[model samples]
Target: MKKLIYSIAVITAVIQFYSCQKLDIAPISKFTEANYWTDIDKAKLMLNMGYNQMYSAGIMWRDEFLSDNMVHTYGTSDQNSIRRGEATASLNLFANEWKDAYGGIKTCLVFLANVDRVPGMPEATKNRMIDEIRFIRAYLYFRLVNYYGDVPFFTTEISLDDAYKIKRTPKNEILAFIHSELDDIMNRGNLPRAENLVAEEKGRITIGAACAFQARAYLYEGNYQKVKEYAGYLINDPSKYGAYQLFQYPAKKEESYFMLFTPENEYNNEVILDITYVPNLKYWTNMSQMAPISKNAEISADNPTQELVDCYLTMNGLPVKGTGKDPAYNENDPYVNRDPRLSATVVYDNYKWQNKNGSVDVIRTAAGTNTSDSYKGPVERQTKTGYYVHKYYDWTMTPNNQSGLNIIMFRFADVLLMYAEACNELGKITQQEWDTTIRPIRERAGFKVAAALDYPAAKSQGEIRDVIRNERRVELALEGLRWYDVKRWKIGQEVLNGTMHGFRFSGAGGDTDGGYVRVNQYKFNDNRDYLWSVPLTQMDLNQNLKPNNPGY
Candidate 1:
């Protein structure tokens, strides 16, 4: 079992500063503010609480709904509302995310304020813990600025009254602060490297994690130079930060890509950062909502779309559309002759699903075998897109589908992709860089053809840009990163304003768009949909929060 050592009870201190008549009567049994910060363990417990609030598996999975990657079967979902261009200032999704991010920030602030008060803690340990808390704070702030631009930003714990009166700060200022903090943490050298982490410290932050975040931060800022600089720190010299590589299963090389998510592969070298979960201790139910109904999934609310499915390249590393279109693509057998990752990530028509009893079951989504009804029937608890998410499903999970698999936040493959994008954007992508990044990724995904593994020497920069973006999409599909990519790339209107499709059910279909199931029609106002509206409830709580995002 992969244990998150920081899974301890949180110790809260209610400091009473003003006592009526100066009564010196100290409580004998209860822990007070004066007595709480005396032990190092208590400080660890406080930091543990911050770790618990850092990231959530459920929220990560739900974020996929914001992009074209996945769709919610229920029309009333918050994500669906946003997809339909009907988002309001009162949307609970906005308010809840805001609340959660701030809640995590507050935990980090509280830890930083009192951690020094703990007695007998080693200086090295203290500094490392401080860096860890700083990373958490930066991560939460990044989440805030990414969702709600110009959010109320603070470094220290504030009074409830002050929180109510605080005004929103410019998002650029917050981004600069995040970059600065991460830089300082990396330079300070307080955090351990990924390779140096003991079993007890498996899920803690490392220098590589900081570098990865810095690269991601620069990517969002569109500073390709800085992106290259930060990402190169890990790509150029892994020994200094941490050693990382694309994980490959020697015994079953064909299934290497799919095996990366199995519980047995948790904390692999490819994983720089992950949300740790131990069986029967800390697990998630999000898979229950996305898994196939035939696998005893509970809700089946989210499903993969044809837009994402079509993004996968054919076996010869050719697109299904445009000038680079694969000549051998068969509409009648769309899934065949495609990249191996297509089968690894998605359960499409005629997919071979593995069973617990060492059996293989063919999932025919269009014909409704080993799955819910076909897309034409439109049943509740069925995949409306005629596809199911196959990645990250723990087959060993109980019937309830509660899984202990750690959700990867930062992985080496993402670093490679970021580096490749930065190089391409800077017009400096050499074959050497291609070999270092994209080629290895495709090779590890079972690609053997020279066309799939070799760099495109003839393609223009714009065509190469498309290649890198598509590579990132198929490589990181259903991993909760597509929404950020769509936003940062500013392609929302181009991709989000069309009717999404499903499997080609030629005959028995009442609503078919050119023989394909019409899943849903979406709208995206590029003007307002880029930034979410500040929740109306938050605006009511603080008058300084007026003037929500443009279209709300």
Candidate 2:
């Protein structure tokens, strides 16, 4: 993918407060007197650029892409090369995101600071823009503190020299700052409903997005009441403020979950805020880069682990409770009753396989299915994970194979889970809570909410909480929330660290060794691994900054 650049130049006889040679270039920037804040159109353009930055090298891919969404444990070569993957400090992106996140926050700040300069800009428009920027500013900083511990806070633009001298603040102080900014946005009535935007403006943030983010913020801090308050508003009147529909199974199972991320459905009611993907938009989505190779094409570097497959609940929406007595389980009843989300998420055995060409192609599901021993005609493209990611695969997107899909950053389903989580933590819910709160999601997923689990069951807080967590993991898999969910709940060891297994394949003149692969499931050997190690360079640049997490 080619690199995309975003900059706003302001001409001035600026003294060197920082060592930023990049900012010292000649006067092509529109921030000058004749163009910039000189008018409303200029201001609108500038503000739009800031938001557009998010879809570029900003928060869209780099920041959220490599996070806990998908676990990558490819060949030994890839694993050994990443220190962060092996739970060490030498990892590349981990050490760099500290600066990357700050760079984005800095850009957002500059846009906000300069908004007033545009002449003839209506007060209402100006205030709305400011509110949006403030929300972004808070969101970026929140991620910084969460991922990198403590780092510099940039409320204003700085030169390279002054930038190096900035010191990290205490974590609490950073949190307080985030709270102040969010509180202001919430009180200001700046955000509009998600449905208000036209087709061209669909991916922009909405009022529900801001409040949903606030609910997450409170969740991280263990502020149950705040989470409940914000999420409650969403649950009671989801149609009015939020947007998300329960999962609808497409005709072909592979297309079932893919609808969520397909470019055609990017602005669907389910998605609140998404990272837009325009094939002609001059930006690169890592989808093609991450997809597996086929008989006639090159495979993606990214591979899924067996652990991820096992995370899928049975057809009945319950964990596949294995029986230790039998080494070989019964295959006759494979699809009997399991978690509904499981089938929608994973392409496992006996299920239909719609070839990339939209034809009902017969693909092997039994053991010894590899054709590495044979030539590359039809069998070469079989998955390495034994199962494939069905969530983002588009049947209509075949021939050209250009993934013009928008990745959802926030959705109404997530809001529902957040509300359920808060309600569970709040002790108990009223009779209305079960019907109005949780049942909608159950009906969407084709699950029969047990009578005891439904409202009037008087279920305990812990029981309801468990149900909510399971629902989220099943429904949101591969959308990119799994790893973070495990870490925040401090269940990495239980969820990640273990021996991963898959079905053994054998047939069609194919023969292979072991044919069985064992991979690492998430688990914590050290407490410090819960939080990512702060980038090593960040600590060296500023002694005042806190050390990488606690253990590093």
Candidate 3:
């Protein structure tokens, strides 16, 4: 298979900043004039630029640190302020997010404006490209509206007259537009499935990706029917989705599912859509700094919170401390006989790190050891919560920490979880529904056959909902979905409040975090923290975006 490699020149975004006083009669550069869009190839190049412009590696990894999943150890990261409840209207992170999203929309609009000018291209390919632009535009709007509630909506490059005068469009309206856009494309677009794409087109938009994004948009709307409809299409009609089953190959039981994160498995059957990275072309993130067994070049960040650790169900499919309906759990050896995902997701006390040789490096998170390998002793940048994210570690990194690991943005496992959630919400979840969705995900995570993955005959809807939700958290841990899920479920007030705990470390007083060595108290201001403050600069540029997200 060919890798999606973008060695082409990056297109200058068509939407110039509002600060620019005047538009030049013509673009001084060759990239902007009629020469560029005269033919098929350059137009495709413009499309590729939109793809590159929209993606953010930070969203894939570091955003998880903002949620309860991981705490910022260094406190210098952008999300640190937001995590501490001190986020303001001028926070650059939120502002940049707004700019990038709208800028992406701008890029797509530019492409759509000129796509009709490209001549002598195959109709199928050209139509597919247009469909992709539609999907990308919808996706950007989805992110924008979700993050900041109301946003300036536009389908075309903003003219000077409309520029500063454009008012905020409600989030619901944006979502409705997204649904219609997705509907038209899915019904009429000649989009390929994951399996249908050539290696060079591996990262191109697909029907499955469109459906996945549409389903997610509806999930945010709390429209269970739309969620079930779209997700069920992908789940039931496997051929249409290129047969996206959970990647369950026969391998070592502990590590079979772990291979999903490896570069070797790029664009596999289960991958719905992934942001592709090509070495020396468009390199992706090097998580070696954050997820490594050592602090060689950089200190680790986003240390997995203990609360996240406890979310993984026991091997017998019970909580660490059993709930009202679930069986009692083993507190003494909570990590043992638990979900196989625990071993795959977190670097726990005494977790194994495979060396290039057949030897293994054991991770010991005990607090008081002087050993360099210990989480608290010799290392200055060890896991803050006594655990590190083991997923997406990119074991194949070069000595200097260069890696080309493509971030899997959407996978079939998420589709299954969505279906399960919608099913439960719609009061239609049954043993059969479990078999199709949640059961397979848990089973792939190393649940024993006929064990916890087995359908429960009599569980309340609330109990079933929690099981599905927790299943989502455990299965998608460290993938950056937990942050959105916490917000979407409106449980951030409950989850993000109080003292966040790390592993039980044997330590006395006099530390920066005080006697409670691993506790970091996070504040979630439920009254207004849900919707991020719109960037102050955006308002300064265009007051039409004013009355910023209430309480900004």
Candidate 4:
């Protein structure tokens, strides 16, 4: 796909700070003018700008917490932002989210409505472009309805004076609106795979991509039947739509899935849906923005918490408490033969982490510079959480340079786990179902079939649910999914809002030292810190918007 780079100043000005003062009257022929959508290229540019909104406020930062990638005890200084984010209150960011999404929604609607009016445009091609825009609009509204319980419904771009009168619709009504839009796209039957895009057309919307989101939208809304139906539609008939398939890793017993996120791999087959990144070319990916700064240019910022570490199950397919009887559970012998994912997801002490150039063990000893690979520059240190995130990042790729790894939107493993979770929830899992679906993942990861649960399990589901939950945590950790899983499942307080801890080498002393190094006990916090407050500036803008979660 040909990459288009817009001036950051102009894009931001148009979206967040679009006041009359900055809206200079350009010549009538300028692209920004109201009637400039007279050509095919101009229409395409407008649609591309709508896609860019997904990169800005939509998923990038929000996913950091929503996906359980990281948490902050004291990152922001705005207390009001924090207040509205209290799990029990309304989040201020939540309100801004509505605006951000609607901005893109209006832009898409306008472009789609006006694209056909462009002279010389073929009717067939124009119809395809309209279908793509509708898909994008449906996707934007899907994000809004999921985050905020209810939202204003807008199909066409509204004038400034008419915008304020928009009323909020109930979530169910909004969801129905979304479903209607998706059904229309399906009926239109013109969606294509990302790979089918000619050399000039990479990163445009595809049929498989639309279906994946359709599946995800239903999954998030607790509509399991729809989730299964849509996911099955994509997975069961691979020959018809060959864009997606489960990973097949022959070298390792556990199959590790990989996809394109860089320029070289941008059009690879495995990626179902991903936002593009261009390092020196366009704005680099969110990974570039978020990864820790390193001197060698091979690492980035971001430290995984001990809480996330504990979420992984033992290698034997049991919880830590359940593994107490096993030798690896001894207090004196932490980090022994543990779950394989633990090593894959985190760069813990003494693990041989290999990057493109070579391999290095991450040992953060306070003695000299407690970090791995001195080439990563001074600021690029290993994680403070006593572990490094390896998922979604190719460690071998020089971290300092712009990275190409595509941020994966969805994958087959997530679907399988979701299926097991839904079946477990609805009392639908049979022994045959477990063997056909869940067992393969467990066995591949070196785990035995999990033991059965008691009747209490039936009421709230069983160890099966916990197993699938942990699998997602370990498998999808740092991909930016963990935090949201906590909120939707109502486990955020018990998971994130707790004491954070990490290990120091055996010789260090004090709290900075991993207290009692040989013994891996954790430091602690309270459950009241559930949700994050929306930023304070947003709260000051909208009064009706409330705080998030509960106890701030």
Alpha-carbon TM-score of each model against the true structure: 0.94, 0.80, 0.92, 0.78
lDDT of 1 by residue, 1-552 (tens): 144332433232222221111111110111225566888766777677667777868778878889999888754799999998989998989888887777667667767877878889999999999999999999988988889889888897555566568888999999999999999999999998999998888888999999999999999889999999988999878878999989988778888898898887889989999988766667787777777777877766788888899999888888887786899998888988899898889988788887656699887677535346344455666677788888998877777877878889999999999999999999958999999999999999988898999988988889889889999999999888999999999999888998987777555365778777777889999899989989888788778877788999
Question: Which model scores highest in TM-score?
Answer: 1
Count of clashing residue pairs in every prediction: 0, 32, 3, 46
- Candidate 4: tens digits of C-alpha lDDT, residues 193-232: 6556776666667777777777777777788788777777
Residue 168 local lDDT, model 1: 89
- C-alpha-based local distance difference test score of model 4: 0.54
What tens digits encode model 3's per-residue C-alpha lDDT throughout 294-352? 63435665577778887887676677744542354644445666777887788877677
User: Could you give the candidate ranking by TM-score, starting with the highest?
Assistant: 1, 3, 2, 4
Q: TM-score of predicted model 2?
A: 0.80
Worst 10 residues of 2 by lDDT: 10-19
lDDT of 2: 0.55
Better of 2 and 3 by TM-score: 3
Give the alpha-carbon lDDT of every model: 0.82, 0.55, 0.73, 0.54
